[model samples]
Target: MSLSEVTARMAKAADQAGRSMDDLSLIAVSKVQPNERVASVLDEGHRIFGENKVQEAAAKWPMFRETYENIELHLIGPLQTNKARQAMHLAQAIHTVDRLKLATTIARLAQELGSCPDLFVQVNTGEEPQKSGILPTEADEFIAEVRELDLPLVGLMCIPPVDEEPSLHFALLAKIAARNGLQGLSMGMSGDFERAIALGATHIRVGSAIFGERDYG
Candidate 1:
């Protein structure tokens, strides 16, 4: 699908959910995509994009920033502690702040640099051991811990098990964010974003749907 189609669909979903267009952010996931495809999207006046790796973002976005104004980058994948500074410099938001160790690293870096990106706690609503998120039961305490570090904890994020229904996870994430008084819910992707918006997703990460299928080769 093209950018306009996605935007129109998102608008319809938000309108149906009683949310204003201003309340939503569309993060075009540009991971593994060619710079030509990414540039095409940029030419369409899209400023907000997402990258899955700090290395990829560091490699790709500087040239784009030289050309585009107000480009907003988001880190939507796992972040290593050592790369926290680079990720902070590259992205406006970090959606995978999953553990205390990484959180502490970010806090220390913020102290030294005197700045930090907006952060979202990633919650493993499905309790998948292989996934990089705090367990649902541990999310509240983790949020508190992040707050103690004085980090900019703007919201929560989750990626549901691919085989399972996404709305359940989205709703669970929304519930967690609500009790913690966080308004940003970074849940949803190409397939179930409408359902996610219905359950309170403030940020939708649409990858191939916006950039076309990625050629990993």
Candidate 2:
């Protein structure tokens, strides 16, 4: 899909949900995409983006950011304790903070660096054993813990069990955010972003559907 197609679809989704398009933010997930594809999006003037790894984003975004003014970058995948400092510098937002050690590190780095972009706590609503989010039952406690650390807590993010109804997971995430008084809901991806918007996803990440599938190698 093209950038226009994605934004048009996003607008339609927001309209259907009775929300303004201006209230929603679309993050082009450029995790594994090549620079050529990223440049294509840049050429189109889409300013927001998401990436999965700090190292990869560190390697790729400086040149892009230097070329394009006011581009907002989000780190939307698992974060490591060691990379917390780098992430605090590289991303305008961090969407996968899930544990005490990492969150602790991020809090420290945010203070030491004096730069704390928006932060989202990742919750494993599906309770998938292998996933990289905090357990659903632990979300409240986790949020409280992070708050005690004085990190810039902003919202919640979740990737549902791919087999189940995405709307269910999206709603669950919204509920969690509401319970905790968070305003941002970083749910949705290419497959179910429309549904995510209807259910209250303030931020949606789109990748392959726009950039095409990536080669892991």
Candidate 3:
């Protein structure tokens, strides 16, 4: 799908969900995609992008940051403790914070640098042990821990098990956010975003549908 088609789909989904198109932000996941593909999306007026790895983002951000002043880079994957500074430097939002140690690292770095970006707690809605997220049962405590830090705790994020229906996971995340007084749900992706919108996803990360299959070597 092209960028226009992607936006149109988002518009349709938002409309069906009784939300204005402007109410949702489409974060184009750019992980593993080349800089040229990212530039193409940027040229099409998509200012917000999501990257899964700090190393990939670090390697790609400088290539475009100087040209796209309004670009908003979001880290949408597992963040390592040692990479907190690099993530803070390149990301406007970090979406995979699942533990206090990682949060503390980010908080410390943000304080030292005099900059704190938006932060989101990742929940393992599917209870997948292999995934990098706090267990759903531990979400409140995790949020409470991170809240004490001086970062802007904007919301919750999750990636459902690929085999199961995603709506359940999205709804669960939305409920968790509501219970915690968080208004953002960074759920959904290229495959199930429309359903996520219907279930109250405030942000959807889309990639393949817009940029085609990514070649990650």
- TM values, all candidates: 0.99, 0.97, 0.97
Clash totals for all models, in order?
0, 0, 0
Residue-level lDDT tens digits of model 2 in 66-162: 8999999999989888888888888899999888998888877878888798999999999999999999898999999999998889899999998
lDDT of 1: 0.95
Q: Residue 209 deviation, candidate 2, in Å?
A: 1.7
lDDT of 3 by residue, 1-217 (tens): 9789988988998888889887788999988887788889998888999998999898888878888878899999999999999899989999999888999998888889998889999999999989999999999988988988867999999999999999999989998899999988899998998999999988899999999998966
lDDT of 1 by residue, 65-107 (tens): 9999999999999999999999998889999999899999999
lDDT of each: 0.95, 0.92, 0.91
Which stretches in model 2 have alpha-carbon errors above 4 Å? none
Task: Name the top lDDT candidate.
Answer: 1
User: Residue 190 of candidate 1: its Cα lDDT?
Assistant: 95
Lowest lDDT 10-mer window, candidate 2?
Answer: 106-115
Residue 212 CA displacement from its true place in model 1, Å: 0.8
For residue 119, model 1's alpha carbon misses the true position, in angstroms, by 0.2
